[model samples]
Structures are given as C-alpha cells and as structure tokens.
Target: MADSAESAAVPIISTSTSTSIANVAASPAEDEAIPVQRKSSSPVTDPGTSPGQAAPINSAHEQSEQEDSDDDSALGAGSILSETTSLADEITQYRYEHNRRYHAYKDGEYWGPNDDKQNNQLDIAHHLYLLTLEGRLHLAPIGDNPQNVLDVGTGTGIWAIDFADQYPSAQVIGFDLSPIQPMWVAPNVRFEINDACDPDWGYKKNSFDFIHVRAMYGSVADWPAFYRQALAHLAPGGWFQQIEMSVVPTSDDGTVTEGSIFDMWGKISLEAGDKFGKDLRIHEQIKGYLDDAGFEEVVEKVYKWPIGPWDEDIHMKQIGLWNQLHWEEGIEGWSLALLTRVLGWSYTEVQAYLGKMRTGIRDRKVHAYHIINVVYGRKPIPS
Candidate 1:
C-alpha cells in the first residue's frame, strides 16, 4: 500500500479548465499518455439545463404537492430537529424496490440504497479512498487535535468511526438519511439521521472544528446553499473538506472507446442527475463553491482512480482492484433509482444496461478511470 510520504513525492498535473480532466501524474515512460492541458476560468453550467431555456414553472397544484412532500418526510429538517431517536418505526420503515431496501424517511431523495449489500460497497469505497489518499483519512490541515468533528452523509459511519478511534479525544458525529449504522460504536462517536440539504442542521453556529463530506455528488440539489450551511456550522479557522468523484470515465490510452457501455453509463448518469436536480459533476465545481462560501486558504487535489487492476503502479493497481468491487456491488443500487425514477427507464432495461456496464467495468484492457477531487478550505478567523 502506498503511504502519504510516497504520494506526496509524486508530481501532480494542474489545469484551470472547467471540464473534468485526468490529473494523473506518471513517470517519464508514461509522459505520452498525458494530454495537453486546457486553460479556462468559466464556470460549468448545469448539464440538465440547456442554454437560453427557461426553468420549468410548476403549476399551483404541483408546487403544493412538492411542498407537502418535503414537509411530511421524516427526514425533513423540521421533523429531524424535533425527533429524539432515529429508531422510530417510521424512520426505519424502509421502502422495498427491485430487491433493494431504501430509506423511507426521505424516499426517492437519494438514489443509493441503504441495504447490507450497498453498505458493504460503501465500506469498500471507504477503503479505496484511504488508499487513494495514501492511507490519510483526510487532506485538511486540521491538526492532530480536532475537538468537534462532523461527517455529513456518513454512510455506514465507517469514516467517522475510524476517525474517532484515531483521535480518542475528539467527538465525532456522523449523520445520514438512513440509520443503518451499527449501535456498537466508539465511545466518542455517534450516528444520527438527517439530510444535509435541510435548511437548518440543528447545530450551533461555528461549533464544529472539522467538517468532512464524502461522496455526496447526487444527494444535494443546491451546492451553494449546502456549502454555506457547512461553513456556518464550522468554527472560525476550522476546516471543511469534501471528496467527490466524477461519474465520467476516461482512459489515458484510448481503450475506453466512444459509445461503449462505459461511455453511455457516464452520459446517462449525468442526464439523470440533471433531471434529479443534483449535479453529478460536483467535482468540477467544488473549488468555486468553497471560494464563494468564504473559505480561505482553499486547496484542491485531483487524482485518477482506476476502475480495474490495470495500472502498473502497485499502489494504484491495488486501489483499482478494490474500485472494481465498488462498481460491481454499487452499480445496481446506483442505477435502479436514477434510471427508473429520473430517466423513465424500466427495471428490465436498467438491468440489461447494467449487465453490459458491469462487464465493461471489469475489462482490464480498458484502463478506464474516474477523476476524484479532494477540496478543503479553512473558515477565516475573525479579523
């Protein structure tokens, strides 16, 4: 496994383009694989919305229904703030669909499932991230003694639990839409049920010493508001870190041909995110959001994460193998709701497409990889 010391020694390719591009750093032999960098400072627009097209105006009845849905959901900010325990029958009343279990509290809000299979996948992804960061849990410069830590969208509570174990003195709180985390946890760590998109997080302002958000690409509809909320709860001089991955895959060697299942998966997933109102391409806009949210000393790191065990670098090869399992276990859960609910695809259609996509993902010759973005910034202390 690669350590942080080794990772720091590797050179990183930097670019100012608005599109998702590979930032993989390689040795002299692999220089030919690097593409010419593009220069641009323009912001990326929502792929779901076209240029010059007016936003959809809902009718009075539709608007009322939407409002009602948000208010009645058990995971709504208002209800979550009032509820004492997440173990209520209503909170655990999971909805079943296509052999998977989803959170009933905020049904249809998040595309992923909360079942054991999906939870296992989430754990695998957690390990993959650790390896990608070279065994470092986070990139933020939050010193060795962070007091109050918040893990937003902490699926499986694995990351938070690990952090609590690492820093025994720190208090760690992990919140997610589902209460699927284990009851047995570290003394300083606890899990809660809440949605990050909620207007109020029910936490005091400027209380958290460190806030960590991971893999929240499609769960948030409003990026700017979400960042502001994260910023609000963070103490001045505290650090806020978010790690997100691009759904689109690219190959340094052109093995990922155009119009393939891999290609279609990326394109369709982006389309579904657009329809769902959450941008799947959040990795491309996180830096700007942090800057606009008033975070200071912001930093962004980009890495190319392989999908299979195809890379020559031993560390990357191991990470790729784990990533392959991630896609395999995660594809069904990731696809079912997004394709059927948002894109209007039938269950049968989604299954067939996933079959092909899974095969493509396992193809070692393809050398396909996704871009993982790690962005962190500090909330400036009062002047």
Candidate 2:
C-alpha cells in the first residue's frame, strides 16, 4: 500500500442526511458528521445496496475499561519481532478456557499451533489494516481519518495491531472476551476483554473515525443496534467497515449436490444458526441497515473464497495450499470450539462433521463458501 494511503487521509468531509433505505427498524437516526476521503457526488446508497450479510454493541465498565485501555496504550511502536515474542507469552499464560463453555469471543480466541503459519500466509491484520488504501473498493465510506477504530471480538490482536501500526496517530482499540494481546506494542492500539454489549464502553461521542467489525459468528444479537452504536460513535465523515463470511455452503458453479459433504455442512450449520437465533438472514440485508443508520457512500465487495482446496489460478492455488495447512493444524481449534461451545453440538458430532468439512476444505468439495462483504459508510463530515 502507498504510504499516503497507509497514513491518515486528507479529504473534504460531509454531513449525512436521512439516507435510510430499508424497512428494517433502527434507533432514531443518530446522524453524525463524518469526514470523507473521496470526492462528492458519490453517495453511499445512491444505487447499490444488498439485503442481508451485515453484522455490533453497547456496554460499559469504566474502571476495567480504563485500566485495560491504559495498560494497552502503554505498549507502542516496536519491532514486529519483539511484539511477536510478547504475543507468545500472552497466549501461553491465557486464563480463559476455550472449551464447551466459552465461544470464540474473549480471552480464548484461537492462538493455536497453526497461528504462525496462518499469519504468514494470510496476514489477517495486514488485510484489514490496509483496506482503507483500497479506495477503488470504495469500502472506507467514513472520511479518511477514522479516529476511533474498534475491532470487536479481536482475535490474536492481529487486526488491531496492524491497523494501529498503519495509522500510528489514530486511537484504535480491540475488544475480546480474552486478553490475548501483547504487553508491548504500538501506543495507539489497545486490547480489552469485556462483553461488547455492555453499557459502559466510555467512548467519546462522535469521536471514532471508523469502527471495523469482522467474523460476526455468534457474538452479536442485534446487528441494527450494533450499527446504531457504530453510527453513534462515528464522527461525521467517519466509516464503519464490517467484513465477514456467510459460513453458508455454496457452489462455485451454483450446483452443489445435496449428497455432497459440503452440502451436509451447509444443512447442519444453517440448522445450528436457526436453533441459536443467529440471524443467518442478516447476510442479505447489510446494505439496508447502513442506509437506515444514515451512513452514505456505502460500498460492498464480494470475493469467492474456497474452503479446502480450490485453485484454478496459480496464486490462489498457493494460498489454497497454505490455507489447507492451516485447516489441518488449526481447523480443530477453531471449528470444534465454535461447534461444541456455541452451537451446543456434542464434541463427537462436531468432530465427525469437521472430518467431512476438513476434507471439503482439502479436496475443495465441502464446497464451503464465504462472502466477504466490505461494507463502509461515512458518518458524513460537513460539505
């Protein structure tokens, strides 16, 4: 990414009007002014808005929040080597259990043996931190400088760490049920463990330049409320980017045999979502929510990701291979935890299901699919 794009942006901002576009119910519009990096005339909901596939919060415990925030803030601007070392220590000393009790929310976010390999291959934080520079995607709807960037349910603190590294001047925070971040790193990035829906976040009003949420598996109940909170924190011209996958099994050619193993996963997982009240329907209504939340200049980017092994392209094949490795060593840690802990499925059932899922990810049959929606909207800075 270009350094300019990596750093803070310099652009005129605008104030958002009532851009609500859906019948979806939302709190009274918390229309706020947000800065915009792109030029005028390009509206968020002008013509494009998809339904579902969207992904939020309220909460507070000022004492712990401040303490965690302070300690996290104290770590700043260091070599990646040193940071990695500290991260190792945190993971080793993790106090939270990733068993059948807690989902992948806090202190026990996966830091398994496969993490190092996965980071080398995908570099999750780099993907997220550099997204703002990808203006063509038009995903960063919030104005250039998203002052308060929150990574909900941050895992490994990877996304938050990189974002802070990229924007050393911005105040970035990562929250999870576990406190697994390094003790020494960039001052701008902080990690905390708390229920995101609590009422004591103690965030300044209209202050966050951006709020980025990812991997919305079972962590949020009311997405509209989540977006509403994002809207509330967004300064005019700010942006909220929610990136996620459907976890819904899909066919590359739109032809998945029900007899296929991937299809079995789709049935079982969708059933799981249904039983848990997880709103699998949200994937279809993402665009509507941003509009209702009064965020304009919305953009969505969809990429087809293969689960196990898919590579008609040479590059993707290499990534596919690496991901397969992650799937081998890391899949158990991630998949089983969510299945048994949150989905309430038995360990044996989840393991049996994963055997098929892992095969799909390996053989590219689970035909498992994902939709990465990079939804962004500026809070609207004054024109």
Candidate 3:
C-alpha cells in the first residue's frame, strides 16, 4: 500500500483546463496543483458477463435428490427456493413506485432503488470506480493486512466481497438498508442490514481498522455526524475513506451550456436533495467534514469522470463508455423518488424530464463529466 505522503505526491489528471488535479487545502488560498500524468489505456472486459452455473446438489438418497430436483424444476428458470422467516419477508417487502423498488427497511430514507435493474447499474458503477482508480479497489492506503474492515452502504456487496478475496485475513462487514447481497460470499466477509445514518451503529467503539463509504451523496443527511460516528468506530490510527461523485456535470471547454438539459437536471436534483434534507453536493464538502471530525493526515484526490466516450485520452474514453452505460441505466432510479416525493413532481413529469436528460447524457458533443472525489483521513493516536 502507498503511504499517505506518497499518494498525495502522485499527480492525477485535471478536468479543468489546468494540467493537474490538486489535493484540497485547508483554505482555498493555500491550494496547490500538480502536473497531470497520462496513463496508457488497457483493455477492459465487460462486467455484465454471466456467472458460471452452480454445482448440482449431492444427496446419498436418490429419492431425496429426485424430490429436490422436482421442486427446482417446478420453480422454473431464474428462481430459487428457500425457507423464509417472518423477518426475512418483512425485509424483502419492497415498496414500489414509478416502477422502481426502494428498500423496505428504511423505506423512504435512501433516494435510490434496490431492484435488479438498479443492482446491475450499481455493479456497473463499481466497475467504473475500479477503472477510475486504475484497477485499485480503494485509494485509502489501508495497508496489506487490515484486520477489520467496514463497508457502509454496501449496495450489492461487490466491493466488500472483492476486498475480502484480496485480503483473506481481513474480516469484512458490509452493511446496508437492503438485504440484496448474495448468500454465497467469502468466508471472511458478511453482510448486515442496518441504517448507517442512524446515531447508534450497534458496533463497539474502536472496532474497525478501515471504514469505507462510496456514492452516498444524497443518502446521508448529516455528514459531520456521520464522520464522527466513523471516527468513533475506527481504531486509533485507522483510516476512513469516502468516494462521491458530483451531481453536477461540467465541461472544461464550455460545451455544456447554461439552461441545457444537463444543467437543469443538476439544478433540479440538487434542489430536490435540499428539500429532502440530504445535500447532494457532499463531494465538495467532505474534506472539511473530515478535518472537523478531528481526523488527522486528511487527504483528498479528485478525478474527472467523463459521462460519454468523447475524451481523447484512451484511459478516460474506456471509463466514459462504462460511465455512459451507468448514467443511461441509472437516471430513472436516481430521479423518480427524489423528484416525485421531494420536488413534488408527478411521475409522468419526472419521466418527461428524465427523457431529455437521457439525451443529454448520450450527447458526445457536450463532453460533460462529473467530478469524482476521494477523501480519506486517519484517526489520531493518543500522545
């Protein structure tokens, strides 16, 4: 793992006209930018590939095996048979609106959905993040053998499973409001259903060696309190890392004009988030929150994530292709609930607005991109 100072010293590509992306400073005046480093693009496989088939159940009794096979055949393809407890039924009792599914546990708290479509989009987003980070799972420098790791808002539990596989010694816990994670997972990893924004996390203090949060922009109402809770849960000298993308799209060349669909989408979404009490502009404020939470050695890295495959840079172009698919598939899930509930727009109205937004997302001429912010900090050890 790269040390904090070394990671900070490495320069990233800047989205602005300027050459380099900089580490955010304590104050705007103290900020410094570094030169951008261009990397050669590599081939990226499709993340949507189908998984291999599961092994057939083995039974000593032929009659038992025959019965099980009959039951499985009765359910048809793409179905599973499992005994469910009352609690399981309640957890899976998803609320449907505008043809999207929201979490039943914290029904209205989160803005996005937990349906199969949205889950696939989340996986695509996970792949985009991996590409953005040049195939690294995280940029926190958490070292080679972090003992206990926590993944907050672990949508599909993809990141947690991957991390557990990479570090077999680590005990990884991924918690979310929805119980959508697969039952089969790494031995060192487990999934829990919990509302992370709640005051009490139910975990003992100083429990985690590393805590990771990703794409939780509009989900967290109070970021300072969230950071404080993370700090409290992290062991001394442990790290807290967060990855968020700006909701607003920007262009270095001014191709994205004011009053355009892209611009309107951003303004209206941010407005809806404000009315909902969870600010969508968390990307711009996380660094300050980390510093305010008493974390030391705080570091921030920002990346330019293109919305479409319009970039001249080969690396960015590949990321843009995946990101374009992410936006295309995710717009409905991202917009429906927030706009209808908070902004008081009708379902039809939201759909109409999103229709135009989809066109804007696919317009390569716009050359729009969202800023991806990665901020991390370490809890200070006692003097």
Give the candidate number with the greatest TM-score: 1
Q: Once model 3 is optimally superposed onto the true structure by TM-score, how far is the C-alpha of residue 129 displaced, in angstroms?
A: 0.8
Q: Which residue ranges in model 1 land beyond 4 Å of their true spot?
A: 1-87
Colliding residue pairs in candidate 1:
none
Clashes of each: 0, 66, 0
Question: What residue pairs clash in candidate 3, if any at all?
Answer: none
What's the lDDT for all of these models?
A: 0.78, 0.52, 0.76
**lDDT (Cα, tens digit) per residue for candidate 2, span 9-54:** 2111223221212221121111221111111121123112423212
| TM-score against truth, every candidate | 0.79, 0.63, 0.79
Off by over 4 Å in 3: 1-86
Worst window of 10 by summed lDDT in candidate 1: 31-40
Per-candidate RMSD, Å? 14.1, 15.3, 12.2
Query: Per-residue error at 272 for model 3, in Å?
Result: 0.3
By lDDT, who's the top model here? 1
Over 1-383, each residue of candidate 1 has an lDDT whose tens digit, in order, gives: 12222232131433333231123333212212212122111223442453443223232344565779866665667666556455476688899998899998877789999998888888777766766665677879899988888999998888887787677557788989999887766456778878899987767678889999999999999999999999998989999999999899888677888998888889999999999998899998999999998999988888877787677666566567677777888899988999998889999999899889888987877888888888999999998
**What is the lDDT for 270 in model 1?**
94
User: How do the residues 254-366 of candidate 3 rate in per-residue lDDT, one tens digit apiece?
Assistant: 88899999888889889999999999999989999999999998888887777876776655666666778788878999889988888889988988888898888878788
